[model samples]
Target: MMFDNKKVDSGTIGYFDTQQENHFFDRKSARIAVAKLSQSISAFANADGGELLIGVEDDKTWRGFASVEDANPLLDTAFDRLKSGYFDAEFLNSDHFPGFVLHLSIERSPSVVYSTSDEAYIRNNAQNKKVTGERLDSLRRSKGDITYESHAIPASLEDLTNSETMIHFMLESDRISEPSEFLRKQGLLIDGNPTVAALLLYSDHPQGQLPHAGIKIYRYETSGEARRDFLSGVPLTIEGPIYTLIRRAEETAQKIIDSIPRLDQGSGLTKIEYPVETLHEILTNAVLHRDYGTRDYVHIKIFDNRIEVESPGRLPANITPQNILDERFARNPLIQRGINRFPDPPNMDIGEGLNTAFQAMERLRLNLPYINESGDHVRVTIPHEPLASPQEAIVNYVRESGRINNSTARTVTKIEQERTIRRYFAELVDAGELAQRGSGRGTYYEIP
Candidate 1:
């Protein structure tokens, strides 16, 4: 299939409401429960957002609203139960296709909002779950409305020290000496009290205060099957200031990558692999953007096929995984700003880290890393291979470059999973005007 930039999936438009989804289909299933309807609106606003189809049913029936005017009073009643400044009437409209139904598109809010009944709701797996306590705080942090890094911690400037990391940061960023003055100048210290960012950056022992602050690495010998010993061994913990944590994780991950061997499918040869730059950027981003308030450590897992780095937070604000590469919203601005001062920092390019990682993967003919936001954790997976199958990479490579070979084919395609590239080669030979040359591993394919 030819992928393009068109937002509307014409083929799947007819498939909406066949089953339950993030979108709610009202269809006058019952009277609009004002309190209940308000929950949906608040949930959508707090979470990643969703649509409210007023005249659609769960079984794919388009039951028209008794008249759009009839639902106005009901919608208003529901709106009254929602917190002020959260929803807008501009989102409500009628469409002809779904039986002249009303559509309410809720954009994810940047702030934490609640219902007038003093309850906050978040959309989770096509349902609205009420949020309270730490979960609500987590939601607020996810939306970038509040950052835990700037919060005051029970520490003084003495708790912080002039470590080698601090010295490096001072020289690299060309800042003035006197760590106390620098901390005060950067708002990391207020009234002689140290902020979370201050201790994490300049302290010799940040974990002494914030026990949750650190990195954990595990080399899982996963058999890729259902087993009890999935992790396979003991884990390694990386401690110290946040910069040190990032570096430790980077070194461990690089060590794993360098020691491994990758098989080339087309050539049937094994070669010593190299560390992907994507891991460095991702690990740095995880540390910089993680939720520091929670008692969770950054976890890095190295497997046979992929590496998973999980941070203790969701994507901040309106930055979803879908728009993460194109959007910019810093969860911890102080950390981001201060970390840039560190010598040989992993994130030299600030906002371009993820996008750069993806481009670098493509340049090396490997599969782009998969990024996902699962509940309270944001996990990024960097695979040690190419995109799935010989068909996709081989067809595209041969189509664009106009030829392919056993050596160049594996290099470009990264097709290491399969025993042979013959299936895709035969496919192209039968469909496209492809011809084979030579014999065995020395053989190549051409289009003439």
Candidate 2:
């Protein structure tokens, strides 16, 4: 079987059985055991999603049920029984070739999922670890960092900002231009005291109040492969009010990007690797979405082939790597909203920044940025090269989607130059893989 829906290798056996994140198999058991299956299901959902192979053995050999038609019902029966109980199981799909492996893909739940025994378990490597006491509370808090941002700081208006900056914030939020009243209405100032958001936004040096609320940038002469910290020209730190920090950090990062060695975009020509808009959007997101509660500054490491911007805190709320494009959540709503009123604001559109950055990179035929999340931080990596050959990828896209335009082709192939799009389309047409259709301005291509 193969996950043709995604870009993965074609395999004939139970997929993800050996790989640990989500795959589980019970080979010794011939019948569908509800208790055992539900435990695995709950663990996978509570952590990251995974697959279950009912008949596969420890050695990766297939046994028992011969077809998906045969395995799905038995699995469904276990879920149906649990439906009216304390814990439940939801099986997405089961695919098998009768003599081969039965594969089931499980969806990870936003909240903690429990088994029939009412025990919530999270995955710790290959085993299911039960959550209790402080771990449970910590897991809930980690799910959404919004609670931390809502806390009012121990500072008063005098500690937060001067009257001028307060008046500016009031004006941007469309409130009566008074400091205390407007801030109180926005929940930023409480009885003449300021919230953490207000303190971070208005303070002369936010790092003085919040130790980790800054950015640390490094320029390495060698690529990250070298892992040579000494090779870096002394690190630079950008700290101040959120507004000032963004400006200084962006200017400094841009200078480093501008002066870096040009990269050959696999087309034999060396050019500046990343688009300015792409860099701006990424840098803005790193600053705004960071967790100010932690004592870790956002770290930006620039290398020859790639640039990595690692922001403090995990992804806020239910936003995951798979659902980031569609799900929107604000960890610091007050600060994010306040920053947008600055002249030529870096965070022009809050939710659309990432999508816009992706499109901008696609225009240049550069590899789109990727997100990596750990327990404490989310890191974004933007590289100079495309994930695949743009010309080849565009052709495959046209073949699959039926037709495409010059503009869409540019985005799909990461070809920023319009002439390049035309040339690539011409090449596909000449090879009889696609045929040009419609007239000028209404031009498109379809698989021939």
Best candidate according to TM-score: 1
**What is candidate 1's local distance difference test score?**
0.72
Q: Candidate 1 on 1-448: residue-level lDDT in tens?
A: 1111122243434655554574442233324565666777778888776677555556655555464565565467545643444444422222433223455556677676676576889887778889988888888888787889988887756647466666666777787668778888889886788999988987877888898899888876644357333674578888888777788778887786565566677866465452467888888889999999878999998776778899998888768888999999998999888777787666789999988888788767677888898878999988877554556667677778877886676666655533466766777788865788878877778875
- What digit string (tens of lDDT, one per residue) describes model 2 on residues 1-448? 1222222233533345445432342232335566666677676666665656566556644455454455555456445433223232221223442243344455555555567787767666677778876565444445562345666777657655464555566566576555655567778865666777876777776676577788899987764575554446788989887887888988898888778766455766454558888878888888887776666899988886788899876676567876787899877778898777666677877799889888888777677788888767888899877667767888788768888999998777655799988888888889888898999999998877
Report, for every candidate in turn, its global Cα lDDT versus the true structure. Answer: 0.72, 0.68
Cα-based RMSD of the predictions, in order?
8.1, 7.5
Task: Tell me the TM-score of model 2.
Answer: 0.68
Q: Which prediction has the highest lDDT against the true structure?
A: 1
Query: Model 1 segments beyond 4 Å from truth?
Result: 1-18, 21-30, 33-35, 55-65, 73-101, 116-118, 161-177, 224-229, 261-275, 387-432, 435-448
Candidate 2 has an lDDT of 0.68
Alpha carbon RMSD to native, model 2: 7.5
Q: Worst 10-residue stretch by lDDT in candidate 2? A: 1-10
> Which residue pairs clash in candidate 1?
none
Lowest lDDT 10-residue stretch of candidate 1: 1-10
